[model samples]
Target: MDPKVLDQAAERAGIIPEYIDAWGQRKVISTETKRQLLNAMAGVADDLALAAALPPVWVVREGESAVLSVALSEPADWVLTEETGRQHAGYLSGGRLALPAGLPAGYHRLALRRELRHWSCQVIIAPPRCYEPAALLAGHKLWGATIQLYTLRSQRNWGVGDFGDLALMIEGTAKNGGAFVGLNPIHALYPALPGWASPYSPSSRRWLNIIYIDVGALDDFQQSSAAQQWWCLPETQGTLSALRDGDLVDYAGVMALKLSGLTLAFRHFITRGPEDPQRRSFEAFVREGGESLRFQSTFDALHRHLTLAGHPTEGWQQWPEPFRQVDSDEVREFRLKHHQDIRFFSYLQWLAARQFDDCFQLSRRLNMPIGLYRDLAVGVSAGGMETWSDRTLYRLEVSVGAPPDRLGPQGQNWSLPPQDPNVLFARAYEPFITMLRANMRHCGALRIDHVMSLLRLWWVPLAGSPQQGAYVRYPVDDLLAVLALESHRQQCMVIGEDLGTVPQEITAKLQAAGIYSYKVLFFERKDPAQYRAPDEYVPQAMATLTTHDLATLRGFWQLEDLRLGNRLHLYADDAIYQRLLADRQKARQALLDALHAWKCVPAKLGKNAERVVMSPILNRGAHRYLALSQSALLGLQPEDWLDMALPVNVPGTTDQYPNWRRKLVREVAEIFDDQGITRLLREVDRLRNKSADGQNSSPRPE
Candidate 1:
């Protein structure tokens, strides 16, 4: 390693040489790298300084006064204080200003504005906390399910699955054995563009993207003359017809129709909807959103400015001056001018919520135990909605990823920027708690994706590759406490996707807190099996034959599963594949032996036993809540082959892969009604019952 490179990188990361020796051994930085490091650090420091010097904002009690302090670059002649808050004297030696006494609070905004230097942020003085979440979920049960939204559709929806479709699905699932219907995130996308689909990589997480709303189902749409005229159009009629026939989802077409309808509805709302309860509810949502809403509104306006100017809003760094700074007067004025656009975005959220609520209500009506098990992704994109709006809460310079393991030789670098837990706790975990509340609103249970993130995340510097990230610890107790409290309050069951090389402590902690962990059948070893047996599965966890990321049961059986190993050429030599195949054969044999041992299989059972047995995958997993994906039930080897031809995700690649854009081959509505699929569900149900009764079955408790 080059010493000069090491020094340069160290300087860039703001590490003293001594600190470098202590922390950066074996890592080298070139002299040329040092110059780039200096430049980047300078930019980072500039951004940090602006963020830190903003305001003395505090969240306090309504009756209490809030004390404030400021660490500034220079001294000010006069201190600025709002009427509601108290101002104090006695400047510290370092030109820091401290408020001597606290002032009564409601909503307080304190700023230091001395001739062209101004900074401000709204602060809330909260009421005493009466809502502790743990007590809520301790004895509560939930009922819910989640699938790709486009998979299901009703006779009344557009080409893509809409609110109407979801409501129907929820009702149907509840009527069956399920209680809730969880959905992929329906957050808003950049409006100007329609087809850049992937709900996970949304333009905004806080706001609902309007495309999912069912225009024809809305009460307001029926009352509107414009909607009636639009509905009469041949194209509109054709679209509806195609949707009922289970056509592929044309996201662009759906978005176009929805936007036009919503715009018209907004006009109607502003002009004639004077005493409507729905109108009032929309206003209430806006008020409750507060500064967070303001930030989104501001971003929408700025994004439009850049878009109209023929620039990609995605490339904000390349934008000209006055456009780059989020707080510039130009951006502020743009917000004031384009307030309608912001309100439009807000309106979309209201509509989505209304639809989501209907789905939840339908599930409750069906009396399902757990409703809507929503999945929360492990992390957010680097500069996406969460990162942009909650910048202070995240460390953009550090990326989260997985360490190299048997599966991934070079490890995994998920380019999501992780939250600065320190900043999160300081703000009392408002971001995390809010996200949970939002999800819980229409969910019966919550599935935390990559649940291990609650413990620690590997952080890589922005300039570094996937392999260079460092492991950083988080306050796991506080994180789990918040989750427990929120989940209990929501009366939702929590399931953690505890796959991969998860630290052992995480599983213990989760189990202790009553959070269910995930168990997959594909990873089980049955020959002198290290994998748990059916009776050995923890009664509280969710048992599954496969996950969205892993191959379906059929694919696993055929040795065609896609994973990081295959994608990264880690298994190019075929040695690993051969071993895996051999292991698979052994596992299959073990399952047959166990079943025969239990007297479930007849002595006449032949070589075809492997092909006939579903008990091994369904009965032999270590979780109580057994979930089989539709693909597995259908014997579909590759989910992508069921419709589109691509894996939902290929782990380590971004541009070289399509992460989450595959549309299911079979429309969701069709699948539910399909005779073949229905039979499979019944068969799986039969096997599950047999296994539960301690009949002839394989080991493991799926």
Candidate 2:
């Protein structure tokens, strides 16, 4: 193979020849890696044909002017169509046409004509920054709690946390003066494959996970006598009791029970009078859902039918040839023949949406500043509906993952196919826009997982190791512009999870776009043995003591995470295990020192870290310490309040450990009912209020 040809293809395909790794080491992409990545991408050689060809799309910052690449032979008449069906015309000069500086911030279209020459392209004008709450802009500081919803224990839930349980948590938080309740990504997971239960790897970001739907909360359940009868059965009650009592979420069992009840509820829905309010509302929802909704519903129905009928049902790729393509005649036939099955799946989505909306409205009614904040997963599962619906938008042979970093020394392949950059440009970012809207709805804030992907992503070829992956550049400037426009339109704030291997330029751009930076207490260390001071934390950030990916505060302090790692055989060698132990010791000491220095922990309470152990005193002190930070937003994990000993997720492990399934040590009601926990929450709110009043949170030196 010619080197120049490969290099040119890589360049045109947006593959970076070299990049700086996390430890400030420069690494170059090898020939074989580039060849593999390029092979997976179609039209790489012709990817940059737009440079001299017709313009794909132009994204302009609000009030910024730029000249389009396509120049006329002479001055031409130009017509502009704004997104709102508004149009304006102008005359161009000297063969070049520049967009007007006064164009509104929205999606638009432009057409240029000079004699017989004519061209048209999409136009996007983005706001200077995303939506920032008035309170935050006025220097108000707020704190809230983040939790893995599935891990939440509720007395009435069918094993795992549901939208009904979420409402209860929201009310509890709001009553305590909390600004918001943050949650894990509740994106739609495979209902047919309930055992494949990682929230980060979802079927579709454009829809909700019906698993979280509260069956009892639905109006249909209220009116359906048959559903109530099924719910009251001895066997049904026994199954629900077992699920509720399990230490880990029984995804398959909970799904089976819910589906049984939901199916009966759907029967009642279809028989409703056309003029019935709920029937009319559901019809409107179906119509508004459009083609994407149809794809999700159809995919779910077909997947369930194939799996239960003992056919190849791994995913669309494994389905019989005739049913593989979403638009195939066989699929259309099946959709019509199984219209009831399709509608059942769609009905589940409608109920989920309604329940989630109710929780958001509950937050608003209680006057929470940000209401419920939603998490957006970085990508979709490879065998999921998103990829099935659009084969052109992704490179199936390569996966989106992270290069070797502190978290995963060998690097991590998420097994999610990377979206093709060229396809995004060709579609004018409608897919990205629509996804943001879906997750942003019924929420005041959205946390984008791996937000740095807006700039670049590590593409690991399926045949290569993650260490052999190369960075593929994205149109960050344009993507961020689109993100800002959507954020403002939805009245939602944006949180960028800039956790690993983030480029410096991306960091600056994120802040410039008014996207909140995520600051984890563990990673915010100055070193393993020391940490940044309280004042050192930036103001435009969401500070937390831990995250779902890491251990709970107590778990971290007790060294349970390291022990678990050892038991799971996660370490590549004894040296790695020893190094992790050493680091944890240093981190624990560092945390104690900071808490004491910041006047959070009592001086007499375990003065020497070597002699100390994790207790309620240490946990409460840590919460107080974090709340006192200068960050505009602070997130507290419920596990810490309850002193849970395990993590919601243990990264880099599958099958060996039960990840994304651990239930909280105590139920939410039990947690908030404890006077100690409620007092801590009240104090946190008071501290935040004190900061809002321009006073230091620390009362005095411990």
Candidate 3:
């Protein structure tokens, strides 16, 4: 193929032929890779020829004039219908029509007619910016607690944190004057195969994870004889106790126990008949869930059945060819044959939804401003239900990853496929819309992980190394418009995780769109010796002392993560490991110095605080330092309060460090009861309130 033709095809398919790296270095994509990607996208003998023959969809900003270009064999008339059902008629003069600029902001349909032939396309008119909540811009500083929900342990929970635990957390935080309770992504994961436990790598982002549902909290559980018998079983009780006592989450064991209890509850519910209120409610949920729900439930049932039959259940691709596609006849037949199994999965979802809804309602009743703030993962797992159901919208031949940077010297391959930008636009962005709506349903705020994905994603070919990846562009304006629309409709504040290799333009755009930026204290410092002053932090951001991916406050001070990394052989060599250790020590010393200078540390620490060892004073001082930041929202992790050393996640290594499996040192019941924890929280609340008042009183220039 000619190089020009290949380049044109790649451009049409939204593939970047060349781009700048994170290190400000220009990188070019190989022609062979471009050809392979284009071929994978469109199964055409000549992509350039095919691109010339196809008509392009029109995407125009609202209040802008547009010209429609048509390939008409004869003189034709065109009809335009706005989203509000308003229709306009016009004639195509020589295959071109001048469109007026006053159309409403929405997805409008355009139909072209010439003799007996007809063609149509969707025209999207998007708003200028995302929705901004009045309260977020009111110049008030709010504080919240971020938790890894699975690690939350309560006496009543079935080993792992549940919706019941979330309610308790809300109560505790609200009592301490917290405005919100932040959570890790609670997206759906496989229940049958519990070993795949990364919340960020979910099966589907649109649904709830059943593992978070408190099966014992169900109303019918206490009434049903089967449920009571299962709950009271000696072996079941023993297993639950063991799970609660374990240092790490026993995903497989806990899920197995919960499934057994859920099965009993389902059997009892079914016996109650369709006229029962609860049964009717479940049916209503299924009806509202529509095809998305049905498809996910079908996939779950099939996956379980296959696993039970001792067959591979990694992904839908491994299934028989006839059953691979969601719309296939074999899948339809399978659904009919396994209707009860599918219903059971649907029932689980309904249960999860109800419990989650209860948490939000309880928070609202407590008068929390931002009740529950949920997280949105960057992408779903490659072998998950989302890919299986919507294969065309994703490019499975390549994975989404980050190029080599300071943090990841060898680069990072997340093993998740990139969404095909062309397919997303061709489908009128319904998938993205659906996902946002589903996730924003009962949350007051939504944190978009790796929010840069809206503008671009680093794409690494499956057969290539992460270093060989190139950046691919996305429709930023359209995506942001849809995001703003959903944020407004859901009455939720948006927070973008714009960390690591982010362009200044992206941050400027996000600020203009009213999305809050995420700022971590560790990254705010220019060097180990100097930290960004509290007043220098952005007011439209959520400031935190640490994130799940980084070392906790205690871990950082003690160099626990570094030692563990070395033990796991995560470092490239002994020199690199030693260099990282030295850097960590310097950072720790600088942090102590900053804390002392800010007067956050106790008087006993004195001027030589850097020489002092890790202690409760240093931990609390670090939290206090972060709480004094000018950022509008401050989030503190429970692990930091308890002085825990383990990190929740370690990037680049999956199984080496027991990622996402560590439980909190203290149980949910004991966390708030500790006098030290309560005192620290009160101090944080006082500082944040004082800062807000000070800001409000200070006059600003007109």
Which candidate gets the maximum lDDT versus the true structure?
2
**lDDT of candidate 2 at residue 146, scale 0 to 100:** 92
Query: What does candidate 1's lDDT look like per residue over 1-702, in tens digits?
Result: 366755544443443232122223444433433443343333443343346554323444434454555556675543435454464333333445544344432344555555587655445443332222241234222223446666555556667777777776665454434434656666666565555566655655566666678877777787888878888899878876765564445665676677777777777676656477888888998898787777765665566567667876453445567755667787777778788887877777777778877777776676655656666766665545556555566676666776556667675666667776555644556787788777666766777777887877666667866555555556676567667656656766677778867777777787776677676655644444434344555556565545566654445544455444465564757788777667766666665554454434455564343565443333322112232221111112113223223445455455555445444565456656666444444444544444444542344433
TM-score of each candidate structure, all chains considered together: 0.72, 0.97, 0.93
TM-score leader: 2
User: Which order, best to worst by TM-score?
Assistant: 2, 3, 1
Which digits, one per residue and each the tens of the lDDT, describe model 3 over residues 1-702? 899988877776777777766678887898877876776576432432344211435667555677766655467888889889999998776767766658876677888787777778777676656655555567678998999999998889888988999999999999988899999999999876898889988989999999998988887787799789878889889998999888899899999989889988888888887798998999999999998999889989999888888875667778778878888888889899999999999999999999999999998999888999999999998888999998788889888998888778688899888888777776678889899999998989999999999988888888888887777778887788788767877888899999888866688889877789999998888777778867778998999999999999878877888888888888889999999878876777677767766778866886553567778888878877877788999999999989999999987677787888899988877999999999999988888887877732222212
Clashing pairs in 2: none
Per-residue lDDT of candidate 2, residues 493-553 (tens digit): 9999998667888999999999999999988899777888777899999999999988888
Worst 10 residues of 3 by lDDT: 45-54
Off by over 4 Å in 3: 43-80, 88-106, 112-117, 123-125, 695-702
Worst 10-residue lDDT window for candidate 1 reads 629-638
**Which one wins by TM-score: 1 or 3?**
3
lDDT of each: 0.57, 0.88, 0.84
Q: What is the lDDT of residue 134 in candidate 3?
A: 58
Residue 5 displacement (Å), model 2: 2.6
Error of 3 at 350 (Å): 0.9
Question: Which 10 residues in a row give candidate 2 its minimum summed lDDT?
Answer: 45-54
